[model samples]
Target: MKLTEVQEILAKSSQEDWIVDDESGSFTYKNDLNLHIDRADFDSYREFNEPWATSHPDPHAVSVEYVVKYGSSFVDKHTLVSVDGHRATLPMPKSINDLRVTESDVNFAKIVNIGDRVDEYLKRARLVEVEDNE
Candidate 1:
């Protein structure tokens, strides 16, 4: 999605909700406070699930929670983890929706307690943008 479109969506959505309009995929949040991306897409609504859960029928992987820490220009401050098990702190993605590595300043790291379970969250916990240089 273009920046104009994302701005439009954000403008239309409520403050309690953050519409993650991007090129890769889109998901909306009730607010930035909670880490869980509630499955409330109007057409369908359900509980948030882990990206790897397959016992029932949901495309979500694991319930990953993230903590965004603010730091200086060259440091990362995002920590991601499962609501239940496993944890991985990732560097922010440079752009939202689209998973493109466009900047050399924003670095991303992946640490997993489990195999590929943490990968899901790490992928989703992308680098939104680089803070403007003041």
Candidate 2:
């Protein structure tokens, strides 16, 4: 999805984005947050599993909850998980929603209220314009 579209969705959505600070110390969006991409039908939402859940549906592969498949930015102050601000600065065609990343990264940003209103918040932070959102 386009970055602007993601921002618009986030700006318009009623649900507050969730953040998960894993034991690994990496802060990410809700576990399996974007699991709704396709294939399954509300199964992921019903499970609402956390990263630490032992009985992941796909036991063969690394648990999607724990891995940094998406929402890879906003680890902690001064330490970035993905190069660009995961959600906010991510390259388009990312598997997950940019809005989700944007919300979480800004949620735990170095400064509070920065993610509350992304346009003004990111601008005030002086973060480089995420080309994807341009």
Best by TM-score: 1
Best by lDDT: 1
Stretches of candidate 2 exceeding 4 Å from the true structure: 8-16, 27-32, 35-134
Name the lDDT of candidate 2: 0.28
User: Each candidate's lDDT (Cα)?
Assistant: 0.31, 0.28
C-alpha displacement of 124 in model 2, angstroms? 16
Which parts of model 1 have CA positions greater than 4 angstroms off?
A: 1-58, 61-63, 66-76, 79-92, 101-109, 116-134
TM-score of each: 0.21, 0.20
TM-score of 1: 0.21
Model 2 TM-score is: 0.20
Per-residue lDDT tens digits of candidate 1, residues 1-134? 33343333332443235444323223333443222222222333223443223222224323333222212111122322222222432332333344433222222222212233334543444434333341
User: How far off is residue 99 in model 1, in Å?
Assistant: 1.2
Distance from true location, Cα of 91 in model 2, Å = 21
lDDT string, candidate 2, 2-96, tens digits: 44544443333332344433233343223336411111122232221222121223322111222222243322122122111222211111222
